[model samples]
Target: MAFIPLSVPNMAEKEQEYVLDAVSTGWVSSVGPYVERFEKGIASYINTPNAVACQSGTAGLHLSLIALGAEAGDLIMVPTLTFIAAVNPVRYISADPVFLDCDDSLCIDPKKLRSFCEECCYIKDGALFHKDTDRRIPVLVVVHVFGNMADMPEILKIAEEFHFKVLEDATEALGTKYLEGPLNGCMAGTMGHLGVYSFNGNKIITTGGGGMVVSQNAELLQKIKYLSTQAKNDELYFIHHEIGYNYRMTNVQAAIGVAQLERLETFIATKKENYKLYKELLEDIPNISIMPVVEGVRSNYWMYSVCFENSKVRDDAIKELDKDKIQTRPVWGLIHEQNPYINNITHNLEKANFYGSRILNIPCSSGLTIDDVKTVSASMHKLQL
Candidate 1:
């Protein structure tokens, strides 16, 4: 049997066609038509007034921190249970990150966030400050883990009450959205003050390596665009007033992204089908369960995950599956546990610690066949016996 791989890109003929057109026109650099078209495509789909294309999701987050005025000695609230990229950008701006725990949905916990605010922080002159660090808390970075939408309604309320900005890391959840509540019909990245999406090879869509920042605040997005292009005050003559970055997405990458965006909904539907199939196949198995999305949210179903009874079982499954040529992986190590963030402040991380150990991501690639999923399920079932 062929290897049933993990999440990978699903490309179409349009990707090749657009990429060839971009190469033929000699407009393959950052300044070209495809870049603008890709930006517009994302903006229209997400219903945002402005979108700025950048090099990667990390770059998007870095630019967002800078645009939101995150400076040295400021504290940015972040979830400990996420890819390190989400928290590293806070350090890039010379700001300290205060790690928060995740709820059952594997996104930032709203209860802990509020409790920390009320118990560990104080509001002075309308600005929230950490009691121990005594640093200004300017923003909260919420990541929609594994395409599941975070509890934006609750998180936003906390942010409003504390007077801080919200930056949504929707890199893994491009198409996920709320189905009910005050955020009905609102997409994952569109609800926050600033939201970013990634077109990495493994995301719902692929641009090889690209990202975008979207917001209702057009002026802030314009400033991000300026900062991305090296912060040049004058194009005719080299002029620089502030440090900038070469974070713009190339037209070639954008060409691929435009093609990928056209098929995002179809890709999401395939993912949904595969996830349902996995659930049905493994439901009867003992000491194992599939993680679920939050209620009333339409997840992109980006990567299907299985939770074992414990870490040993999860690790043993990965080793056992490899013998059958089926690829699987454990969840990312808690970000706060990383060497650089060892001393960072944390609040009530019980759930994050619990889920981080036992969760194993399974194959849900859009191109995966039913037979492939069945083979993986069979192998997983045998592990429990």
Candidate 2:
């Protein structure tokens, strides 16, 4: 039997036609019609007014920091349990990152965030400042972990109370949305001041490698576009404006993205179905349980993760599954524990540590079959016995 892989791209022949069109037209470079079409395609799908394409999610996040006016010595609040890419952008602009804890949703804990704001931070002239590090807290970077959105209502409330900007790293949550709330019908990344989405090979959608930045401010997006394309104010005489980056998404990548975006809804539906199949088959397994999204949040279920009794059981399960050609993985190591961010501030990390050590992701590709889920579930149960 072929290996039941973990999350991987499910590209159909649709991508080939688009790529062929781009190549045939000889518009495979930084500037092309496909780039504009891809940006508009994503913006229309996500219900955002404007979107800017970039080379990668990290680049998009870094551009968002620029859009928010992040500077040296600024503090950005981030969750400790997210992928490292989400936090790395904070350092790119020379801003400090202070780690926050995650709640049951596996997103930032709003209660802890509020407590930290009230107890450890202070307001000066309508801006927040961290007391311990004495850094100006200007922005809060929120990641929608595995397509499950953070509790934006409470998080936004805290941001309002503390006077900071919200920049969402919705790289994992392009199709997820709030079913009911003040943010009802609002897509992830759209609620924040500026948000980013990734189209990596393993993402719900793929552009080979690319990202999109969405915002309501048209001029800010224009500035980001200019900055992405080397900040060229004039093309004829090579007039350079400010510092910039070659972060624009290539036309070939955008062409692929346009095809992927067309099938995103179908991919999300398949993911949800497979997750349900796994839950039904494994619900009775001992020492194991599947992770679930909070009520009213329609998760894309990008990667179906499980929780073992402890770290040893999780690791052992992964090893056992790998022996049978089934791919599985443990969750990311906590960002706070990573080498570079040790000196940064960390709030009450009880839940983040708890989930960090126990959570393990299973095979959840859009291409996964019901029988494949059954195979994984049976393997997990055998481990329990």
Candidate 3:
């Protein structure tokens, strides 16, 4: 039997046609019609006024910080349970990151966030500064982990009071939406000051590898586009005002993105359908817990994950699955525990630490068939024995 991948890109003949068109037109570089079309499609889907295409999700996060004026020595708050891409941008700007804990849904806990601010930070010259580092804490990069929505109502309220910019790291949640409360009917990326989406090979969609940053602030979005494209003044011959980066996505990649976005809704529906089947199949397992979609929120179910009772059980199950030629992956190790970020400030991460050990991502590609789901489910059920 062929090994099932944990996640894989779903591309069809349409993607090939788009790539061929771009190649035939001889517009395979950055500046092309496909790039503009891709950016516009993303902006419309997210209900944002402006969107800027970039090379990757990391570029989007880094550009957001630069556009928001997050300078060196500044502090940014991020969830510790998220992929390192969400937190590395803070380091890119030479800014400090205070790792916050996750709640039941594996998102940044707003209550704990407020507690940390009130307890460990002090008001210096009317700015909230960390008491120990004395760095001005400026932004919160709220990641919607695995397509689950964070408690944005409480998070936005805290941001208003604390005066920190909110950058929604919706890299894994392109089609997710808040179905109730203040953010009801709002898309994941549009609810924050600036939002980012990733189109990596393993994401719900793929542009081969690309990302987009959207903002309600048109000027800021334009600035991000300028900075992404080496900050060159279009009118001048070779005039460059400030330091810039070559982070723009190529037309070939954008061509792929355009085709992928057209089928995003279908991909989202398939993922949700697969999650339901997984739940129904694994419902009887005693030691395993499937991730829950919080009430009134529609999750894309980007990567279907299960948590064993403990690390030992989770490890044992993984070994068993490997013997059966089934692919499985453990969740990210806590970022603060990593060698690079071991010295960073970390708040109480009881839930994050607990889940970090137990959670394992299973094969959840959009291309998965019912048989694939059944095979994986059978492997999971056998572990309960």
The candidate scoring highest on lDDT is: 1
What TM-score goes with each of the models?
Answer: 0.99, 0.98, 0.98
* Candidate 2 structure quality by residue, lDDT tens digits, 1-385: 5698888888889899999999999999988999999999988887888899999999999988987888988989999999999999899988879999999889999999999999999999999998877789989999999898899999888889899999999999999999997889999989888999999988999898999999877887888888888888997898997888999999999999999889989999999999999999989987778988878988888988898889998888889989888999899999999999998889888999999999999998888888898888878877853
**lDDT values, one for every candidate:** 0.93, 0.90, 0.90
Top model number, TM-score: 1
Quickly count the clashes in candidate 1: 0
Query: Residue 251: error of model 1 in Å?
Result: 0.4
Please give the RMSD of candidate 1 to the true structure.
0.8
**How many residue pairs collide in each prediction?**
0, 0, 0
Q: Output candidate 2 Cα RMSD.
A: 1.1
1 versus 3: better TM-score goes to: 1
- Model 1 Cα shift for residue 146 (angstroms): 0.3
Compared with the true structure, the alpha-carbon lDDT of candidate 3 equals 0.90
What would you estimate as the lDDT of candidate 1? 0.93
Off by more than 4 A, model 2: none
Q: Write the per-residue lDDT of candidate 1 for residues 1-385, one digit (tens) a residue.
A: 6787887889889999999999999999998999999999999998998699999999999999999989988999999999999999999988889999999899998999999999999999988999987899989999999999999999999999998999999999999999999999999999888999998988889999999999999988998999999999998897988899999999999999999999989998988998999999999999999998789999999989898899998999999999898989899999999999999999988999999999999998889888898999999888953
